[model samples]
Each structure stands twice: as C-alpha cells, then as structure tokens.
Target chain A: MTFVLGIDGGGTSCRAALATADGAILGRAKAGAANIRSDLTGARTNIVEAARQAFLAAGEDPDLIPQTPAVLGLAGANVGTYKQQLEAILPFSRSSVETDAEIALEGAVGSGDGAMAILGTGTAYMVRKNGKSRPIGGWGFQVGDQGSGARIGRDLLEQTLLAYDGVREPSPLTAEMMGVFRNNPQDVVEFTTNAKPGDFGGFAPKVFDYAAKGDAVATWIVDKAVADVEASLGVLGLEAGDPLCLLGGLAPLYAPRLSERHRALLKTPLDDALGGAVRMAVRMFAAPVEAAR
Target chain B: MTFVLGIDGGGTSCRAALATADGAILGRAKAGAANIRSDLTGARTNIVEAARQAFLAAGEDPDLIPQTPAVLGLAGANVGTYKQQLEAILPFSRSSVETDAEIALEGAVGSGDGAMAILGTGTAYMVRKNGKSRPIGGWGFQVGDQGSGARIGRDLLEQTLLAYDGVREPSPLTAEMMGVFRNNPQDVVEFTTNAKPGDFGGFAPKVFDYAAKGDAVATWIVDKAVADVEASLGVLGLEAGDPLCLLGGLAPLYAPRLSERHRALLKTPLDDALGGAVRMAVRMFAAPVEAAR
Candidate 1:
C-alpha cells in the first residue's frame, strides 16, 4: 500500500512522520538538527535519516520508499534557492518544501485562518488569512526576534551590568545573574564577547521565575517582552474573532502574562508541525476515488 | 639623562610616546591592534614593538630600554589577571598598566579632577575626583555599552527590519540600510549571524548623517542614544564644578546633540591619551632628589 511522508526540519532538530492517504499517522521518528543555513550537508543527511527511520518504524517495504510522496516544512527554506535543490535530490517520488512557519501555521489552524507567534529562543510571527500566509518577524537574533527568549536573556544581562555600575538598582534577579559569572562584571563581559542567541537564552527561565516571584526587575523585563509580543500581534492585526496561538519554548511562560485582549483570542494548537506536514502530504498526494479504483 | 615611555593599546591600534622626565613628548609611534582579551600574544608583541618604535623615533639608545620606565593605558586590561602577567615580562625598568579609559581620562583631564565620556564604537565614562577614579559602562556590546556606535548601528538594523515587517514606518535611512543587505531581511539576518561590534559600528555614521538630514527614524534613534548618554552622565553625577569632556569617534557627532545641562559641563580635553600616558609614566618613575643626585 502507498503512503506519504511528512517532515519538519528546524535548527535544533528534524522530525518525520509516515501516514496513510486518509491522514492516519503510521509512525514517527526524530533526528538531529537540520538548519539549512549553517550545515547544508548535515541537514540533508538528517532529513533523509529521519524519513528512513519513519519508514522503518512503519514496517513498510524498503522498496516502497522510492515511490512515497513527501512534504517538508524546513528552516532556511524561506531564504534561498536550496528548496528545489533539496527536492530534486530527495529519495521520494515527489516532494514540496515550505517554511517551518507555514507548516506551524497549518498545524495550528488546520486549514483555517488564524495567526501564530513563536516565542522561543527566537521569534517568528505568521498570519494565515483566506488561504494566504504572511510572516512578520523571525529575521534571526541579531536584527530581529525582539522579545524572544534570547533577547529577553540579553536584556537581563544588560540590566545586571547596569546594576553593577550602580546606574540601576540591583535586584535579587540581577544579583543572581551576576553571581553566575562570579559576581564580576568583567567575567560577564568576557562571556558575552562571543555569545550566541542560545547562550543568552540560557537565562530566560530565570527571568520568568523571578517575574513569578514578584521581582521588580524581572517583572519589568517580562512586561516589556509581553508588550513586544502584543505589538507583533497588533501588526498582524489579530481581530477579536481571530484565533492566535503561541508556540515554542517560552510560549507557555508568556501565556498568562499576555493581556486580556490577547488572552481572549489565545488558542491551543490543534496539531503539531509534523501533523501539519502530514496533512500537507495528504493534500499533495491523496489519490482520487476513480484513480484509486 | 632619563626617558619615559607611554603606550595606549586598544582593539584597533596601539600608540606609544617617548617623553622626558618632565613630561615633554619627544616622539610618538603607532602599531596594529593590541586587545589583550582576544589577542594576548598579538598584544604583547604590539606593545613591545610600539615601545621600540617610540624609542627609535626619540633617538634613545635601544640598549637603555631596560632602564627606561613605561606606563601603558590598554584596553582589555580592566577584567583579567593579565596586568601582572604583562608587567612581569616587560623590558622596561618599571611598567604600569591601566585601563584604556583611565588613560583617556588622564589624557582628557590632565592632572585635574573631572569626568569624561568616551562615545565611540563602545562607550565608557570615567570620573576622577580628589585622587580617586571610577568607571561606568563600557562593559562591551553584548551587555552594557549603551549609546555606543555598535549599539546604535544594531538598533538601525533592527528598525530596518521593523520597517520591512510594516510594524514601523519605513524611512529613507532604514530603506538604505536594507538596500545594503539587498532588501532581503534574510540577507540582513545572515550578515548579522557572524558580525562583530565593529562591523555593526560601520553603519553608525550613516545613522548620524541621516539624523542630520532630519530623517524621522534616524532622529528618533539618535535622540534615544543621546538620552542614554545623558543618563549615564547623570549616574556619574557631573557636579557644577566638575569638568566634563566627550571623547572618541562619535563624540564630535554627539557633542552638539547633548542636552544643555551636559553641554554646559563639557570642556575640551587637556591633551591626547598619549600625553596622559606620558604624564603617568613621569609620575610612575619620578626620581627622588637623593636618587637623582
């Protein structure tokens, strides 16, 4: 019997699912990172490995893989001409590629119209209206991704330094953050000299934790972050009737802190990114009744 | 016949001055970057090479180097144990090392008690009062260094991305910045993935130029940057009697934009950093009358 394959490839990891044409999932598998920008060779390898694992887990004939149709929602696909290149080389009989945000929107809304904001180590905003989708942020950490966990963590570090300089009042949160770098502003400075977004993101949970405990500085940072999220949602024009889902690691932390206006429209995703890819696969390859007969 | 050496080492370049015990500069020389944090080996080599150049320029006997005292005002000397390490290996009879800001302060204020803010690719504020000195900010781009050129340029890129997303109105400056990255937010993202503070700083001049032309976004950014500078000065507690000087690459651009309160306190530098270093060298090795006899 024929089946379809769905893959969600991201910076940190890749996941694959094997499903029937009716959208019933058969098997799922996961592999290492597939960030097409930094490690194209590694990403291509991981994507195929994930698909192979999914096929094996489904207990399908190995020969059937050559004929399986696949759809991939991948990071780094939005920027370059590599999508067609990756498609041309895949083992599947047919394949299509879309951005990770598009698949996330598909999985969250399930063919419906809505918006989703991912608030993890990075940030990306997507709005799907009347079958067309537009992305707002997710430009990456340096230039965009405002109010993301990485940005929040960076802000925390900055506040810690300000407190060190006596420019700002020291708080328990800032003290603790400085303590991690040995209570030495110099060490903190050294650490940041070569820091990446994920490295900075390591402090995000502390911000949320301190905010929960009513730490004034932490509360201020969280408030600013939530305000940035609201601004993106406003730019996306989230209406009273529109559903908005928050996704990614920091989403849950930010959920309760969001304003009542957003809380009212906030939604839980119906399916995950892999499920969305599976649905996309079905859309791409589900046979007509006459063809099936 | 005795001579003194003064060296000013920074991330970009190193300068040296050879002067008499009375602090009359005899010669000056320059060398490549000498930041201790990122390039310890290079810093050591550059420091010695600069001293050699100064000595040669001054027509001093190279063989008398071991008897000639030296003072260094070096960047990256603030945070590490390298000061003692560097001192232990110098070729001079006596060598003293201080932070670059300290030298700049020495250079800017001479023997007087006062304050100065260096607003270049990074920012640092120093106040010397009654034989004591204190520093504020200059923690580096990832943490502090607010109102710095690097921070300003990064802010420009961020605003450009915001305009691209339609979250903010696009201005000519932001448009030009995006144009540099080929109008691709992804391209901008990719460029920042590996950009250093200096790379970001390269765009700061554009921000100032646009602000001069009354570009709304550029004006807003410049105003906010100047405000941050003012806040830092306030934190430094510039007294009515205190002499303040603005130094560094962006200082001239920011000098006119400063609030009247700051402009009123601002004064001209007494000398360059090398002059400060030479004065310091004289102080470090001024012979007692008994020793002189």
Candidate 2:
C-alpha cells in the first residue's frame, strides 16, 4: 500500500509519476520546463503541478497526497544553493534533490554502480559509484555539452550555413536544409535564434533522416556524434567490458553508430528516471519517521 | 588622359578607386556592402558614394569627372540572373561585371596568366588564361565556399556550442568563444542569428589567433581550412610548377600552414582586385568607343 512519487525535471519539460513500492506505475503527468537556473518559480510550480496531476490521475485526493514521499531529479539541482531552494518548495517529509544526471544514472542502472550518458536537449555523462555521482560534462548549451542532441543540431545548422556560404561543397543534406528553411538563409538564422536547447535538439532526428538518404554531410555529422559519445565513455574510465547505459531521445538514433567496444557495454534500462525517483522515495521513507524528516 | 575606375563590392564593405591607364592609383574610397543580391539600392548608393569620394579625393569635382570605363568585382554578381539585376542599377556607361572570384584571380596574377584562390567572406578558386576567366568553385556561401573565412567562423561557433552542450570536451577555443560572447549561452544564439557571411568570415582571424596559442579546436579548424583550400586548388588543376596567387584577408594567415607544393604555387598579388578592375577598365576603353559601350 506504500505510494511514492518520482519526478524528472528537464530543460524543456518535466515528468512526474505516482508508483507502487515495487515500481508499478499508478499514474503520471507532464509539465513545462523546470530548470531552476532558467526559472525558479516555474520550476517549483511545474513540480507541484505535475505532482498534483499524478495524484489526481491516481484517483487520490489532494489532502491525502502529503502521505506519500517524493524524489525529484532536477536540472540545476546539483548546485547546493538550488538544492536548498527546491527543498523549500516540495511537500515531501522525506525527499532528496539531486541533478537530473544523477537521477538518470540511477534510473538506467538500478544498482547505482554504473554510468549513464544522456543525449537529450543537451548532453551529460554521469557515473555513480560508492554512493556518489561524478559528472564529466554538462556545462549547459554554452561551454561543454558535446555529443548531445543540441550539439548535433548545431552542427547540422552550421554545415547548412557553410554550404550556403559556399565554404562547404553542396550535398543533398544542404539542399534538404535549405528546403526545410524555405531556401531563405534568414530563416535558418531566425529558427536558431528562437530555438531552445530542446528545440534545436529536435533536429537531430532530421539529421539522421538525411544521412539515411545518402547525404555525406549528414552522415559525417552522425559519425562525428558517435565519436563524441565514445570519447565521453572513455573519459568515464569505461572499459570495453564495463556496463553502460545510453538514455535520451538521441540514444536510439546513435545506437547504430557506436563502436563495437562501446556497444557491448550498452544496457537497456529496466526503468527510467521517474522509476528511479520512485525507488529513491521509497528508500527515503523507509527510514524511521524522525530520520526521514 | 584615360581614367579607369575599379570597384570591389563585398558583403560588409565596398572599395572603389580611380586609377590612370597605367595602373597608378589616383584616389580610393570605402563604403558599406554593395552586394546587389543582398541590397539593390544600397549597392548602387554605396558604389556611387565611393566613386564620388574617390573623384573628390583625386581633386576632381563630381560633375567634372570624365565618363570613365569601370570594372566591378562583386560578390553575388556571378549568378547570371543577379548580374542582370545589378547591370540595371549601376551608372557606368560601359562596364564588365564579374564574380569576386575572377577579380581575385586577376588581382593575384596581375597581367600574367595563372590561377588564384580567394578565402575572403566567401571562398573560390579561379583561373585566368588568354583574357578569359574559368572558375573552379564559387558556388556561393551555402554550397561550396570551402576554406573561406565564413567556413572557419561557422566551425568555431559550432564547436563552442558543442562544448557548451556537454557533448564534447571543452577546448581553449570554445572557452575563448564563451568569453567573447560574455559567458551567456543565449548570446551565442543572438550573435549567430544576426551574423552576415562576412561576420562569420571575420572570425577566421580569431581562429588563427587562437591556433597560434596552441588551442586544439582552433588548430583543428585551421588545419581543416587549409585542407579545404588545398582541395579547392587541386580542383582548379593547379600544378606545383604553376603560378597560383593567394588573395583575401585569410590568405596570409593560411600561408604558413600550406604544403610545400601549395607554397610553391602561391604568389603575392602585385595588385589587388581594385587594381585588376582598373586594368580591365583601361582595356575596355582602349577599344572602339562604340565597342566599349
């Protein structure tokens, strides 16, 4: 009868779920971006809104929601200051705030002794060992998030512009990009300017699609992306035989491009970050009531 | 005395000069971009303004100026359709309009017959022989301006974003870009969105500057640009023993990086595009007045 709530707050969107102690999903909800670095109040509201939806979907009353413990995997929560800020907003008597990277790692490898590389709106490589998480990269969309969907998207846009500038020979990929942007170079500028990390990241699939059609530039971009991911795995001290997990919308697209050494290390997760959050919540609440608080 | 006017109109700026039939410069003027494809009225006004200034600088009143023949080396004027559009607005009674690529070639070789590569706002390779111009590549900024300043700038920006997204390891080059953009990821978007071909081309110098400091990403960019330029030279049928002129702002930066074979072909221009334009104007006016018109 024990209920626990798990939340994964990302840059573009947030997901929350109500689950049983055994990882059975009872209900779930999704909301807008809740990254504290960009929006603090929005982050709080998104978490609360997602939680309320999950509880309501589970046919539970609002007053009864406080009985369950919660765990939040949030972007920007790794900063100590942000962790304190989040703790002030959530109602969980037993709750833990950690980076989305850490939560993704726990979700991908239930045992918490492995590593996970996330290739979503941005990219992050995280390892959890000895009850601590170490991250190699995840600086954001400005300084060091390589091998991520956003990186791939940015590359695609750049090559397209290079082709437009006649600095790169034209390939079918250039034509496709030009067509997508209606052949107006200004549109490429406009779309990229207004794009969020996730919005640009979304173009990763299109890059793959073009590559499949024999676009050399597109293929080059994909191959480069694979190399970037492989390099990240190497930085994590991951050997050829070590266990690793790939997560995010881009993982599947890049899966076919990984090296055999890295491919052998890949493992499909039994649960996602929300499930990991639920497990964390259950463990937190199992403590004595005084210790839990 | 016969007077000749030579004009070089590019994406960011225009240069015009009045010269004697013997290639002696009398005066010169600078104005903003006069690429007709990007700006029609602006292009005409810029040329007229620059010509007027040059005439005044040479101690001639605007109305007293002779109806000198002119040669315009302009970006975007190579496209046959665009050339016609430009011809309609320019004031020259008789003029020859050619791609900046051709002008760069004429500039590099002077009155000699040879080949030249330009890595300016855009990149192109052209060969001049028997008074006719043959171009190897000048496909515009979107399809094949390899080794150009614009390509290098685009690469630098893409690498910066990749580093910021945690998809790649941070390099000193990426760090430099972050610092230049004020450490704001959003500023990257803003700067790139508003970027003109020349703006991206402008970053070529920064890439070289960073490469000199041993930044891996900058070095990679420079290496790639050199490769691309060499490839363009190869396509132009440039032999080691043949004369090849290197013109454009980026040419000097790339000189130290070229292969001996390329270095052997490289020659400093005795006269730039402006001088070549003057030469062309003089030649045109030397013909029968009816033929000149």
**What TM-score is obtained for chain B in each of the predicted models?**
0.92, 0.78
All-Cα superposition RMSD per candidate: 2.3, 5.8
Displacement of residue B219 (Cα, Å) in model 1 is: 1.9
In candidate 1, position B19 carries an lDDT of 88
List clash counts for every candidate, in order. Answer: 0, 29
lDDT of 2 by residue, A1-293 (tens): 36778899998898989877555788999988888877888888888888888988888765655677788998767553888877887776556787777777777887457888887777778877667677866655533466677878877887887676555677987788889989966577667756777777878888899888878998988888777778777767666545689888888887778888788888998678878887677656543443545
lDDT of 1 by residue, B1-293 (tens): 48889899987899999888878888888998888877778888898888888888988766877888898998767666878878887888988989888888888887778999999989999998887899999888877889999999999999999999998899999888888988888888888888888999899999999999999899989999988888888887777878999999998999998888888988899988888888877766764522576
Tell me the TM-score of candidate 2's A chain. 0.83
Model 2 stretches astray by more than 4 angstroms: A1-4, A19-24, A63-70, A76-97, A119-123, A137-225, A239-242, A253-261, A284-293, B21-23, B64-68, B119-124, B129-225, B285-293
Give the per-residue Cα lDDT of candidate 1 at A123: 95
Query: For residues A23-109, could you state the per-residue lDDT of candidate 1 as single tens digits?
Result: 789999999998877877888899888999998888876578788888899987877787877777788888888899888888887
What DockQ does model 2 achieve? 0.14
Error of 1 at A283 (Å): 2.2
